[model samples]
Target chain A: MNDVRSINCTQCGAPLELHGGHRTRSLNCAYCGAVMDSHEGYKVVEQFHDTLRPHCPLHIGMQGVLKDVEFTIIGLIQYQTEEGDTWIDLQLYSPTHGYHWLSDEQGHFIFSRRVRDIPKPAHISNFKLKAPVFLGKQRFYLYEQYRAKVQYVEGELTWIAKQGNWLNITEATAPPVCLSYENSVSEEDYYKGHDAHTEKEYYYGEYFFPNDIYQRFSVEKSAQDKPEGIHMAQPYQPGLTAAMGQVGGYFFWVGLLALFVILFMNADEQPRLKYHFNQTELSTPTLIPFKVEDPQKLLEFRISVDRLTNHWVAYEMVVQKEEENVLIVEKEIEFYEGRDSDGYWSEGSREARALFKLPAAGEYSLSVLFDGGSQSTPPPLFVELYEGVVVVRYFLLLMALSLLFYMWKWFHRRSHENRRWEPVTEDEDD
Target chain B: MSTSPYPAYNCAACGGPLTLKFRYTKIITCPHCGAGLFLEDKAVKMRGLESVMADYPSLFSLYENYAYKTQKLTPIGQVRFEYAHGFWDEWWTLMSSGEACWMSVDEGDIAIEQLVTLDKMPFMPDLQVDVEIELLGESLRVTERGSAQCIALKGEIPEVIMIGDNFDYVHLSGAKGRLVTLEVQNGNLFAYEGQWIDPFEVKRL
Candidate 1:
């Protein structure tokens, strides 16, 4: 509910216009730069002799359009930091839309409206980059934070805005839109310049592009020369960045899909034959014969050399081509395990396998020729023949390929994001 | 703060007085001659011929200023395409701040749009209209699907303007404020999102 009030400046003796919105406790004289307490019959609370007016294009009663909504400028407040950094805020009010604000700071205009639907963190300081905060269904990321001291004030305002107000302002930008939280760090946060105090908290801000602002309002510039300052939201390549995100997402899912399909296809696998042979069979370094029942597909022979730690067993294996003609193939199996400061580490493998396809599915003979072994303890050797075990090998290769593809896509996206956040966010949120 | 980067110039083709509104605009339709002029690095050339869009005149016309919210906008150029149902026009618009957007007439409705790139679409181009597809945090429906041949083009284009070119596109409708269109052009998929805007709200200047 808005309670209208009227008062005259004590110093300038000019009529001071008061605004609606039940929050005005102080009003500044636009004529003589005199601060007045509107509640106490236009009492001269504070006065400034120096003329330090911020450059503003809109004045009270001037109407402008933003986001296709028509709003009138009703008030203007100037806030300065301890380091002399200052920005001007123009209060915008519409009969149908209530109230919002257009803040011009360092040539960058921020269109802001108080948003109650924002989910704030328990501590306002918890806002930082990579930390996600949600507003409605849209999630916003904290981008920057600042602490400002409100230095001066003027015009009609909703809140009794005074000077020397210590406000902890935290901002998170989602490009085109920025989420800002103004917290009164303490009772001293609202200084009211001299003798007034106003407290407000939650705020939602959006970075209006220069083009959008130019279209929204008739901007009156002091410099009628060249257009210089770039809009805060100007450099963003929305179309390209949006496309990059989409492409990155597509590549990532494609890689994941390929990985899962490969895994599912190899989940069920069975070995054909598993056999054990003792030193008595391999003692005679001669070719010992064996026959396979079926060998249409490629069969792999895994020889497990059951030797001592750090020991190796070397043997020559031969598979007959069904005509009793032996084809010699050499193999060695060794395994070593040891402990160090970094804990136990293992090297080599105790098993070695050879895979090859036979001429046909008919009986194919195979033999093992042991080259080096001690006869004292019968050399224990086990052989396992597997059918269609190449799936696992192919899966490893595909997984690596998919991982590489995703890595490349994400790396490409990272390059774009680096540009998005490239501007050093230092003291930018005035 | 509003200044046209290119000052008032004469249309080379029609020798008519033309003024460019936006800073980044490279093409504009001559108000007097209605000829599309492509501003090049050295000279202005005649762009693709303008093809008629609708039987009745459009409520908005080329080079005319229309108020979209607090900002004043001017329609710069237009591209005409024929779909399965009929023909539609996409008007190139420049905002007061020099930002550009495109407008299309969809089923007797004005759809204000901007080019947006999306990652991918779940369904193919053959997805039926009204099939709900969740994208960009909104539930969008598959709407228009057909090949649109660029039969007529006039005005400024950010890129090269080509007439008679064709592309197959799938349009997805998201609520009243959002429309997603996925178009496949020469094997490259392009996406654009738009909102259905009320023509009554547009103040003709």
Candidate 2:
């Protein structure tokens, strides 16, 4: 009995035992009752069973099981007796197998081997009711007669077909029907669904056969292969507008943003001293009087305000020179906002127009007053220099364009020379 | 999504169709009414309502509540000299809960920020302000509620008065204790001297 016994329901932990009569045998568990079989041993069932079956607790989805099992649901058979007890029959796939009055509930599909989840097919002839339909979590169906064409494009197998007109079919007619296969089905069974069309295309991902349908019409899939000036996709399409649009807008906006950033950075970047030192003063060891290359350019100032009173109090600037013995010719601070007339303040109103040129090219000191204690709050002030930055920028731009033009000329000349170089070809060797 | 099926009124003066500007508070008036015949609640009220609401919509909406109970305002203080003032019973919406409630307001220490029915107004300080809303026979309190404050001004900011990210408005006083309003407008927060500078003007500036 122990040798004849198989483990009971492994999932819910039920014991199974032998049932039926002496003529016909069945496996039934007594402790946690689950009736499994009537036949004594294993038997061959059906074809579709090879691809899909009931899930087994002992074995996982794709693993092999001990028995050959197949079954089909045909119809629901019912009966009623004089005692008023109800009975039913399930028209199964095989004729020899018969099950009787078990319970009031409908019967379930059972397979000896575990069922597997199938992979999705690349193409399908029909969009609706397509496989693999999940009968249960594990059980699935590949369905019946449908057609698809599988061709190798690039490294992947993609399905494609010639337009129906090429097949001599009606203008409105579609191609032959195809079946979508569950992954458990063999590749040969998958190809059987592919109709024999010589003009049909085969694709594996993006790559396709040289004579494929897409290739035959000269369709270019990538942006690098696209020719200049033609119909294009929306700005969002991958190769058509996406690439060029991004490059166009990206460079434009990026250039604009970069310009603003550069201006802001330049504005914020403040022409800081890469290195500041009194070279002549250090060399000669003087207490003061150092020469500066451009005394007009050195304007390093910091503004401080009283936090409590919210007042602009003072501003301090440090100036350096390149040579000694330069006298302080004249120097005065000036301020303005919007334009010169909106509000203007200088060291002295009368001498405001006088140019404060350095006498002998040496370091000098300058300071300014935040308020002369006037009732009218002078508009926000920034130290203004007579020299405009536009001249320097224009000069730099001209210098850069000239350099780029010459560099481009040199690059083209070198490339042309290199291509023109010939190591005697076989025809030329003669 | 609930739709009001009631037929709207037409301006009696101009013969133009009148639409409800506020939810239940109906001050039906024609735009061509030439700024006269102000409708507070259901009654024809005053003349300067157009200018009053220009500076404060929340205040005008709340003031209309008094019209509901006594049918008008009781003449009080300075208002008694110019026009009649009264208090009435009406529902004021608590912006935080989106529910209509009864509240009250008085003549003294009237905080405009506290009286607002909705927090959608663009103002300054941006802190949750205590509102004074006048309701029917009683006053209800809705606290820590108001829209995000956004103000604008012109002139100068001496210290590192950062805007956005953390603070909304910084009240700074310049020379002579002159109050200057500074707020984030467009992107830059400018410093302006007078309260007379309109919010829209500051935005444009």
* Top candidate (lDDT): 1
**TM match of model 2 to true structure:** 0.16
Error of 1 at A153 (Å): 2.0
Across B89-199, the per-residue lDDT of candidate 2 in tens digits comes to 112322323333322222111211111232233344442233333322223222222112112111111122111222334333222112333345446544333211111
TM-score for each of the candidates? 0.37, 0.16
True contacts kept of 1: 0.00
lDDT of each: 0.64, 0.26
**What lDDT score is found at residue B200 in candidate 2?**
11
When summed lDDT is taken over every stretch of 10 residues in candidate 1 chain A, the lowest stretch is A191-200
lDDT of 2 by residue, A392-426 (tens): 35544644554454455445444533332221122
Superposed Cα deviation of residue A321, candidate 1 (Å): 57
Instruction: Please state the error at residue A423 of candidate 2 in Å.
Output: 56
Q: How much is A157 displaced in model 1, in angstroms?
A: 0.6
